[model samples]
Target: MDSLKDVTLRPWPAPKKEELSQEDLLVKIEQLASERGHLRDITEKSLQEDIDAGKHIPDDTNDAVKQEAKEKEAPSRQERLEKVFNAGKEMYGHLEWAKFAATNALDLLSLVLSQDTNKRNLSTFSQTFREQGLNQGIPFGSFGISKENHEFHNRKPEELQRIQELEHKQKVVAQGARMEALDSAVDEILQAAKQLEKEVRRQTKYWQEIVAVSDQGWPLQRLRQNARHVPFGVRYGLPEAGDHFKARGFAPLQMDKDGSIILDPALALKPKTFRVRVSIDGKITGTSQLEVEVDTKDHSIQKSIQLARDSLFEEELYHEMSLETRQLLAYGVEFRDSVISVDAPLMGSTSHDRKLLIDCIPREDIVADSHHHEHDWLARNVAEALRLLLAHEHSMRLYRRSQSPPPLTARTQEQAPPPLLRTLLAVFRHLEGVDSLYVCLEMVANTLNSAGLEVTLDTTRETSWAILAESLKEPSKRGLSATDQLLEIFRKPFDGRATLTLPTSNGVQFESLTIVTRTIIGQPTFGTEHKLTLPSSLTSDLHLFQQLKFSSVKEVTSYLDWILPLHIAHRLLKSEYSSRATIKSHDSGITISSRECKRGSAFSTDIKVELLEGKLKATALTASPLSETEHTEQSHTWNGGHSSTSFKQVIQNWVG
Candidate 1:
């Protein structure tokens, strides 16, 4: 709690000096004058070259005669030096008074310090004299004033030391006070910052709640929750918006439980004329004046009321409203005429208009989701409905504002929309048709661009379908009907059945089928014929096979690496066959052979697969037909193919 006023110390007083005799003073003055004169001489000499340069005038007249005349008029070097000396003498005389004044001031200061009682003053005076005396060539040490005499005139050493100790203590106290004040200030600042942070967080949370309500649309419970949290100053006190409805030429008596605004039957019995104004928030947005004649027995007014209400609160219609319209709805709705006025905020508006219509109608009404058949029509029309709802709400707000009493002061111009409202409207315009499939396709195109794929939706779709059509078994047909046919395009060769076409050495094409079979009753068996044909020159070239295309080699090697172990394990576990499968790759071909023993009936299959002129060739040795047991096993394996598991394993291995 130390105050800033307590942090300052008293200022030190000026020192006194000893008096000098008149003769000595005069001598000192003369010596100082001589020293100043010498200094003046040095300064003048330093500026001599500049002074000479300034005096020189260049000759412009024709050479010989003009040069000779200029030389005669100019002063000689010796004469110029004499003129400079004379000028220096005049300037020295002018400065002599100033020099004398400075000398006398120093003498006066020394005299005052000599008699000063303050020790600090006396010491400062002595130090100043010592420094200046050395600089000016004056004998301050020879002044004949002893330290003892000087000390006796001022404070004693012990007294001066005590004064110094007291001053030090005061300084320490002042510094401590200053530090305490600074600490207190910093603490206050921190507390203020913390309070400011809390206020910011509270405001942020409040705004977040408002935004959530606006975005989600206000349900009854949510509206109530919002009301509870709203500051008292901003809370609207009118009955919920759902309690009222507006119709031309009819005054609403009450709202039914189903949300229809029931008009007075008496008023509706005869011809009547009325004007209606609707407002949302505090602004008038719409007005209608009408004349109506209805039969009391027919309940035509109620029917008209229900129809008007239905048009106002339709869900499909609501979705099509623009941001400006939605903002109006948010402000609430108002209905007014000469005899009656009603106001309803949008927060309490409900989607029960259809139910209300049905309750008031004579016959049952069928409610449909949408009137449009095309998917795009529904999307586009839904947006239009929202815009309409917003526009109606805005009209209601305007009508309400117009009905209120005029203020004492009038505004020169209408207020512009708030910045938040303007921003929301801009966003709505930007995403106007976002629900349409075309817009969705555009969004997808943007996604593809973001992911480093340079593709547009139309181009991508066309290319994909073209590729699919080409791969189909019935390429002539325009439609793909089977799921398996679509899935076949993505299938790989390792799933146990692969049909490969290869050209023979004579240039004729042949087909080879590789089939793997496994069954519960017997060992798994794999059979394939690989026909390998190499060009005559490359028949002995082993390097060609070793340096095959990396991707193709990897596919073949991986398939073998995974399938060989599974085949061996299945044979060993069933105890029906002890099989040895050998796979070797050479320059001309890849050779695969499997020898198995099942119930002492031995069988062997050898396949040679080769790469010849960038085409795969497979050759298989002729083998006997499979017996009943083999056929049943093959059929069971084919029926329960492990496509999904094999595909997953292949993907995992490739990724690793």
Candidate 2:
């Protein structure tokens, strides 16, 4: 009874208005709708502003908007939602563009700074060398070799004349007729550097002003503090010490917690105590230590380190300059025994030697062959570095050329054909006669057969004609289908023999031939050699195959210098249908593949060609199989193939 004591309850608050007239209810509804509309407008504007500012919006905001639209079933609400999302996409695009521009600006600044430093160092080296009387010129004897035995020194007189002409042209432009051109170039570079610095300062100030006005603290100061951890010349975007440095005998000694690179002691060229003065905006800012080493009691440490660093920097600068200069001069330049020698072409036909002397500080004599050993390593390193740099330079040059508009002269000039196309055309012209064609085809078939791909020829010519027609529609089906068609025509195993009969004006004639040829084309495979029977008339053409054994694309072009028109033609054709063909090269050889296209409906064809032990080996793979009838038709068409004119057109459409 005590646990069941009565509990007090309070009634809920009465409704403000239980009932009202029609006019009052309408008025209340209108007021409520107006308030809701005002709130919706405020939220929409806020969200739009956030998106425009590249700020992330709360997911709940989106969910709430979507829920309101679902409840109201309003088409306008959905449309507004779409507009907001589109605005976000536009903001993202702007953000990406900003990032790209910033990155490129940093890279450009880094490159300019590095170049300035290098130029300054080079000027110092030249002054020091001139003062030391090292400019007398380097002699061939300094290279520990007789001048008469050197390849450049032994060049013909004609080559020497050509080299002189080239040198004169360069001197006219680079040194100027009055020696003012070099000065002008220098002034331009200096102006560019000043402009770059000014731009950076302007950008920094702009950001700083923004921070001040917004009362967001000094972001510039934060940036500067973070920048202190960045390596000199790398703050913007210089290449880091990595495999490239290591391969040149430089190794990392320590990696600081903040990611600073400390080179290995054994490989460091500069002494620990030696420092390079650094300046910014014409004022001394600080100093940079070139290396790290423990303190020593030896008093000559400073002198040794300074000499070493100077020598290294000079060598590197010279190497880079030589590569750049080579682009303007065709002469072969070599460095040996502190001497730089230029092998100029004499009279544009033969090479002649010219030398310049560079004086270097004598290294401490510790071992008998110490100087020789060190110089050898330096030379090797310079050579390798030059090779890589030149490759990169060439690639960039090509890219720039592609991006820029062509010069007026270039646009108006008639271009020459590629060597490969010219050579192919010449071959076709030489094999124009039916007898010649038959002999060549037999030889080609025998070569394929010997390489493990069986080949047969159509006796009736009908089957070959059909195959050729089908191949015209679908080039990819040509390889394997043609082979199958050849097999069907003979109806027997390939014996590397062919016979043909032709009706002359007066009587019928019989021609018999045996072909036993071996070709190295395609992927490497084991097989016995076949005795290739080339017609006596085609013996000279055999040299083409022999040359191809050692030929890369570039080598092939040079080797076929007499057939430049073909090469030019091939290049033009390749560019026109680049999407259908792919050509790749490696140390071993090149692989060329063609994709299936609408004209023909067969699979792709892949051909790999490489030189193996002085033999040109080629392996071809067909992507799909074909029926006997389709194969026969393709073979027949191939047999009746194109004339020289038509052949050229086909090549233009198909080859890359």
Which prediction has the highest TM-score against the true structure? Answer: 1
Summing lDDT over every window of 10 consecutive residues in candidate 1, give the lowest-scoring window.
353-362
What digit string (tens of lDDT, one per residue) describes model 2 on residues 339-432?
A: 4443211121223322222223323312232122323332343333333343343333344455756666734754321121112122222222
**Residue 564 displacement in candidate 2 (angstroms):** 20
Question: Please, what is the whole-model Cα lDDT of each candidate in the order they appear?
Answer: 0.35, 0.36
Q: After superposing candidate 2, which stretches have Cα over 4 Å from the reference?
A: 1-299, 302-450, 453-631, 634-656
lDDT of 1 by residue, 233-283 (tens): 111111212223222222323333332323445233333222223334433
Give TM-scores for every candidate, taking all chains together and pairing residue i with residue i: 0.16, 0.14
Question: By summed lDDT, which 10 consecutive residues of candidate 2 come out lowest?
Answer: 232-241
Q: How many pairs in model 2 have backbone atoms within 3 A of each other, for residues 3 or more apart or on separate chains, i.e. clashes?
A: 61
Collision count of model 1: 43
- Native RMSD of candidate 2 (Å): 45.3
